[model samples]
Target: MVKPANKPQRLSLSSLKADFSSAVSRRRLVYLLCTFFVIYALCYQWQFLVSLGLGPDNIHHMTVGLIPAVGAVVLSLALYWRHLCIASVVPTALIAVSWIVTGPYLSYITLIQQNTVYLNNMYDIYVGLYLFAILFCLNMAARQFLNRKISAAIMTAVQFAAFFIIALQWVYFALYHSCITTSGALLIFQTGPAETLEYFHSLGVGRIVFIALFVALLIGGLLFANYTQKTLPRTPVYRKILPLLSLLIIFPSVGALGEEIFPQAFPIRTFIDTHDYMERSALYAENHDGKFAALQAVQLNPSESPNTVVVVIGESETRTLMHAFNPNHVENTPWLTSMKEDSDFTLFSNAYSCVWYTVPVLERALTEANFYNNKEFNSSISILDMAKKAGYKTYWFSNQGSIGVADTPITLVAKTADVSEWVDQELKQSTMDGALLQFLQRVDPNEKNFVVLHLMGSHIEYRNRYPKEFQVFNDGTVNQQADFDNTVLYTDWVLSQIFEYAKENLNLDAMIYFSDHGSDPDKGRQPDDISFKVLRIPMFCYLSEGYQARNPEVVEAVKQNKDKFFTNDLAYEFVCGILNMQSPNYDPTYSIASLQWKMERKDLVTRFGKVSLLEDTEF
Candidate 1:
């Protein structure tokens, strides 16, 4: 087709790409990018600062966000005035050292409190430096593409908006992580417009005013960041060093990549995963819905006076590290060790945790589920169901978390009981397990009951597990073994208290105590790992005089099978054998207490796979 000469030529839209190069220089871009990270880190982590300042003792205080953010700001300011670098290397050195101590390296104190090896302190500094370098490089690289004044203003505005939202989210979570959790989210999730407005109304005018001011401060900070940039001279060495910094970034980029691939380790991703667990928990709830009621309909006969069963579930405990089990010369668990000598106590020397993770392990352990076949895990009748059907008042009092994690499979099973009570509704490690004892004292002793006490036993960041008084083992050293021992001691105390409470107040007959899984004290950074320590848990049964008279044979058999290999996944059946409850799901073959029990020969099972504790192979 012939085109008219008067007609304009068509412009290709594909060729159009906005350029901000004239406004933003490589150095200025680097400065701005660096500022963005520093500011965001500050806003997100300011809540943690209150903790770092409080020292190692008050470790529950969140400080990671605040320390690094402040450090970055100092560094950014130092680099801003080119003269600050030219003035003297000494001041720069001082400033750099300050950051290493208080910023990313603040993990130093945190690791010390965890009782980790001294090597972890060096590793902490290296990680902190690497992180600082990564952010430093990023700020520089973004500025490499420059733009005009208007373009720069537009870019700054965009960055400000993005950071503002992020700042708000961090601020909200600062308050949230301190207390708010899945239940609160679910409450907000289920609330309608009227309810939402009522929630705001409940915050009241004074609180509302404070919230408004808090928001305003965040906006003001953004403006201040822009001002800081304007004060700096554009003349810079950023472009020349960009390649070196970028090359340095490659090492830390692996962290970014890992965060992308395994986001659960990252904060935002962790929040999402925690929330996702709730969603999965909801599905778990749905799958098991009405199944408990169905189990009750089965018309199972209860043994005469089943008495009381207190299934005390422990967390992150290693039997090998325990004095009652191995001692390792750390008498951290003196009371438990003493209790083990009592004739009433029957210890399961070879008890293995069903899995490493909390939710997965609890689901399998409590339900009629096996490691290989998990179908019935979500659908089958639980021990709580068996308890309820047998005409006993079932109560679940968990130190872990009660309300927010209702959808979690473990919580779901807890809810299956007649009454589920959580001592720590916030679900943060901030609360000590001793609070569980208070809830125990409240349970009605007159009723025929079954209670499950989910303890936060020696989970990591060991210092937080106990109060100041429990710091009996090497209180002044960065000895993780000591800290771990103290936690075990603390756990020993907690278990003792529960046992005493059961004996004193409630209709105490038989008590079964076991851990969900063990933890590698040396490696966990908020407690995550799997090894022999992660699987081996101290499980034991304590029978009162009346129970021994009624079921002497079962008690005797339990003692005999202490050396036999067994996974805690079969704990429900074991309890059934002790209680003498009959149900389709109750297999005497799996219970160590039952004479018909068949030992899980050779391999000890776990949530991931099986490992023989006897063999010197990798767990």
Candidate 2:
């Protein structure tokens, strides 16, 4: 026995090989998981990390922390690269790419620039990551059962669809400098074929070609990567673990937390919100007739004489960009600027739209339901109803869309007028606001008239909003700000035309002008990224000598409150007060033209009272 022991136990080659293989397997497992963790963190938390690292307050952290953290991540990724399974890694990478390429990351950056505290918090990051993890697990499970060819086909199709969506979002961001939202989707649903064509055409050939090429290359590369991927030998443990992980991730999203978490995901969440909006719009339409019928008539107190009043509702006109409001800006509103010298003309220094969208803003601006009143929108009576009750013939002339697939709440309010006319009968053309002047020509001078002129002022595709002659800011170059300035100029011209016609022909006693909502020239009026400029609308009242004489106290009140904070949702009450009409809905406190009118800066709000104007530093 001793002689046999003395020979020394020789290590078996197969045993040594088995030990080395086990260690390699363990390292590969650790690396594969690290890869998943890295992708997950980048997909959901990059925006937060970026904001944290690059924020003005984080300069010290950037020097000491961020750079080292980035280096560590790079090293980890390199180590993980060799162990990555193509079946898992490729789809995850594609999903991560979608998150980056789509509008969210860009929008996040833009928001952070404007406001340092705009980054998503840890809670939001976790929710997004959880949802993404569930999606990844499902993708893994799909690959586990399907053959390599079928898996590749499915993966390619998914990536292609994702690429197509990303391209659409990219194109939208390029044109609007913002993300496509539920409101944007509503605009799409409301748009007619001709308008849709114009929208795409506005993207120009260069952008169109770039988007097409970019998408084609992305899809082609993704397809190649997916198809050329080599199938790795999957263990029974892996097969079991993948299904279990998928079930675990899916359980939370399908259970109580699903409703809250799932809607936080992009593209899918956008689609969900759009669908919800459609359903709400349909319900509103269905209930609108009854609501209209149920509206109570307000008591009419006539003026000393039959007055011809015109309310000019401008679209996407921010006072911050108007020369009359911001003297530092370009002189695009020379007519309004000169009108300021007139004794009868009064320009409100602080005026905001209750909401930043056309439909919601107009719904409240034209109705008795204001942000402060808490009145139901459907139940409230419109300005048309109030005017008609006072025995004035009401007319609505709009250069904007009148009818889409469904009647918007604003359109419903517009239709309540004695006559409703849209420049584009089918919303099929890009008609200038000048076309609305033709409708004003039909006004009967003898009758008491209340006319609404809704102009497409400074809306998107700003170049199309004006004629070639009105392109004063153009230097034979593509400048969005210049195009916007040209639109403001054109709008000023349009306003002057409307005012002169009403004054010279229709015995215009009083004329009021206020935009439905304002817009950001750089970033169109996005609800989520609302700035004070987006709510800071241009508001002015032009009182003829006759109106000034008859309503001197009201005129005095208007002059006094011109510098006070006013939101357009109170336009109804202001109109009532100015016209010397007595109504149950009339609240002198809300009316800027009433001696009792009062509003504090703290009380001011926008986005239908959801956001405080105090949040905006510009306000």
Candidate 3:
């Protein structure tokens, strides 16, 4: 093809306006906006409903959720109302503003604002999208395969079903705080096979009648709307362009099929994925329940003097980063270094986190669970269960979030405790760790209590982990290192507060502080890096004056184990030894303070999938 070589045309505002007006009439714009808005709502329905049940931020959630439905109804009316020379702006304004405000860019913004991580990031709010895709796809498919009469029938059925579901969901949410899930289904079934209907009836026959009546009204309203939408007389030119819109909608779901890849840009797929997760989660919950119930009871012997044990679990911290433990003189750990020389505090020289992740490591550390006998450990009962049975109050205070309670395995452990309080609502980095202290100060401290404080220490996105006022080494180092040191410094301050309270105010026994896992400080080290620093964690015991005066043997154990090679897999047994609380599961060899305790080749588990073969690591 030969170029005509015409001079390039300069764009102008008037020409642009004319092109836009010719391409998209007000009626077509309304239809397009309404179409896409419906799709967006479908993707976010689950997230929106969840936020509604959350403590705060429901107003924003409500706005995002309702706009699409209002747009849909208005657009449906506009279809027939236009024939009667009624105002189209009623629908157009609502649909147009909603579409642009909650468009793709807005979806990304909403996702970030929601502070969703992992699976949730894949599912949370995106500007109105999922519903539109389904509608547009249905219309285009109908246009190709069926006549206008059949197409109308198909659309009405879909719209009615969708409307009915939405109505039903509202009532269901009112009755129960949550949506249908596998755990809920199992719990319902566990009540009794025949009690499902009786349970519904128990809500009162009046409530049932009201729900039925409401559903009937919604169905009638949907039918009326569908009739008007179908009977609209004029054929619009935008109908030709709708096929093109349908292709664009379909493109996200199947566009990568040509390259043999399936991406997650489609909204409807998130809903499907959520449904699948619900089913799987429900099955697992049911199976786990049976095993848990069948397990032998947790047994513990209460000592002559009831002990008040406190466990502080830190995050993403390594001994190599702490000034108290590391060769380098890092001022980030000033408190720990100052406290190290105190006879009441015992700093363990050789300690390693058992696993790389928070939940996995804590599961075994707090309970008896391990990779080897997971079924038995998960079912056997936790230290919290035993603590309660032994007549001690157990409390779980966390700086982390309580979202995804079912999927978060640590939540199951938390439930075994007498009291569980999560200070952080969102999973964002800005939530301070000091909030855990508020819960601690308010709780009854005089009683025989076992409290666990989970902190967000030195986790990723290091810059967001600390405030500017607390920053120390920012001007002349890699920013990641400065941010990391800032977190550790903040952690040092936070830990000192807990210690002061325990020693000065509470009837404290001993407090043990350790990390869940260690991370490479420079940032972004590969998971496969077999470095000693990544697994090595700083652990110390702060024994109150009363505790030391009562149990002299625990002090001796701490002294003897100061140099022992400690892996956190033995943490539960060690806790048992520290508190002198004996259980049948407790092994003398697993306790570092015990003479029989010894490190073997099989004891060391590394991130690179190695065991029992560390070359140069020593405590």
Candidate 4:
């Protein structure tokens, strides 16, 4: 490619006008602007509709979700519109804009690139591509019809086929994913591919009905288009405005709004479907007293304390696969195995999470809440309050969804710790640990500290939770085993790094790590399904050298006490044994530290049918 010598070019307003007119004709501009504007408004309103069904920041989530869809639809339409008229460059440029907006970008670079791979993959599920194909054909058909180049019947067939395919995806998603009392099937659909197929296979009558209805809609849309054409108004504006407005208003409202509002009235559906998802959370509050009293031991006891206590709340960690719990499995817990041996640690062979999700488990464990249904407990006194009462500084950190819920406990935890950090999904995973480390550094060395770190851990779509470098499966073969192994390894590495920080930086007395609940390893159940794996978690304590020396008895007690423990026992056991605090809710029967009742057996089962090896006998 040789560079030509600079050629003088004439510059004039007339030349610019001619170029602009050629690039974008007035008729095309009207159609494009009308289509895009209508689409934008409908999508924006649909976003709001979807948010209405959800709690708290439903608006924020729906907004993030709509970004890709809206961009893709607008761009796809523009591309088709230009391609229909045989205008090349302008359509291509519009497509490029859509791709860049929806795709990944390097923050530091000016080289604007789009992720075609992502778009290509999305074509199958997204309805926008189908819509583009339909409209392009329709536009072509309309042009031909006006020019007398094609028969009405042939054009009608194309319109009908396009309408059917495009409409089906939305209908399917709505019928299946809508959060309504009647559409629990949507839960099955949204879960993933296997579940959706399975549900389809099982639906004998429903499948037939859906097929029939789909055909009806297809025939209806085609007839409507054909009838409108025969009665073609003299004004093009009527043709332009009617179909666009109808689609813009109907598709999103019926799809998004209907799906969200469907389940709003159902209390059971809304209540149990939460981060705190134990079936009978309210019962614990009903039957139990002194919900916040158990923290007395952890807060009041001077012998167990030197400086800091970190309560790292994990999500969905199970003991069956944890190498520490299952010594037979070498890879199950390679990191924890090394950590336990390297650091002077005490491992409880039997420890179970009381509830499965973060909110209920954390709220119940930290606060004076007995159960998950007890919304009043969200504002109640908690372990943070106990630490505040004990004059110890407290801090809470998390990497979870629900920014509103994240702040609830953190506010209380901050009142006690003098400093707290609540990290949500907004921050990058790599940046989170650094932010926490800085918070730890900023705290005064003179004050006793209570720091809590909540992690996403091995949650579903496990691949996304961890960085790629930690992914051990090289063949691109993904399954439950690979996902589990990768998650365990990444989490183990994270734990080790945090432990290293504890070792080198803070003069910590003890670092206790436990999960909120366990997840099903079978991959046969829902993510929220209660199983042994869901309750079983890696619960252990790492005692710093400085604190161990000062609290010899506490260390001895930890060394000796190796029985099964339920998280419900934490407030009682840790408080009585470590913090040396006293409370009436500190029942000897439920307390892990109560030697007198250590022989008693109890059935540690949650309302969601999750049971674990807990207690000496059924309680």
Residues 1-619 of candidate 4: C-alpha lDDT, one tens digit per residue: 9999998988899999988887777767677678656755665554333221221223344346555445445544554353333232222223223322221111101111210000011212123322333343344335433633243455556555534423443454355432121123224334688876676677778866887787786565444444443323434543565445435533653364235422321222223353232222344344323544443433334533347777776666676676767876547567688766754777767676766665556656665454322434444555656655566677766555322233334333333445545442223324223334444566555667777777777765454455667677443444355666667777777787777776566666777777767766445235354455566666777776766666666667666665555554244245334443445434344444444334332545443324435522421
Off by over 4 Å in 4: 1-257, 260-306, 339-343, 371-376, 401-417, 423-435, 473-475, 521-529, 544-561, 568-577, 584-589, 593-603, 608-619
Winning candidate number (lDDT): 2
Q: Sort every candidate by TM-score, greatest first.
A: 1, 3, 2, 4
Model 3: per-residue Cα lDDT over 1-619, one tens digit each:
9988899899899999988887767767777677557645554454433321121223344455445444443343333333432122222232233332322333333334543221222212322233433443554455445666665567657655534433433454467533332233335335775687888878898998987888677555434443343322224533554445555555642333223211232223333344544454455456555654544443333444555778898888888888889857468898999997788888998788766666567767777665434434445456666566556789988766443422255666675577886653323333568767777775575577888888877776455455668877774543366667788999999999988886666667779898888877554445555466677888998877766666676668778878777777667767766665555655656776555566654565644234643654443
* Candidate 4 all-Cα RMSD: 19.4
- Model 2 bad stretches (over 4 Å): 1-306, 403-407, 426-430, 475-479, 610-619
Clashes of each: 22, 0, 11, 27
The sequence of per-residue lDDT tens digits that candidate 1 reaches over residues 1-619 is 9886887766655433223443345666677568656654543343243232222322322234334434443444445334333222232222223333332233233223332111112222223333344433333343444433433344346444434423443444445532223354455456799987887798789878987887677545433442333222344455555345465444544464354322321122324545666676687678766675455333233336535679998887888878777855577778778887898888777778766767667777787786645546667778887777767889888766443332267777787677777654522223578877777765777778888888777765576678789888875544266777788888888888888878887868889988888876555543343566677888888988888787767877888898888888888788788777766667787788887887665655564555555652532
Ten contiguous residues with the weakest lDDT in model 2: 114-123
Candidates in order: C-alpha RMSD to true structure? 13.2, 11.3, 10.3, 19.4
Q: On residues 1-619, what C-alpha lDDT tens digit does candidate 2 reach at each position?
A: 4564566678999989999999987987777567655754464355544332222222332233333223322333333344356655555445545655444565454444322112222223334334334444545555567777787778777656645655677677777565554446668767999997897798889877987888778767766666665553477755675466457545654452365533554444556555665665576657756755655454434455666999998988889999999999999999999999998899998888888777777778888888898898777777887787677899998876554322256677886788887765522233778878888878898889999988878876565578789979965434267888998999999999999999988989889999988777666434577777788999999988877777778888999889988889889888887777675656778888898877787988888688776777864
lDDT of 1: 0.60
What is the full ranking by lDDT, best candidate first? 2, 1, 3, 4
What lDDT is obtained when candidate 2 is compared to the true structure? 0.69
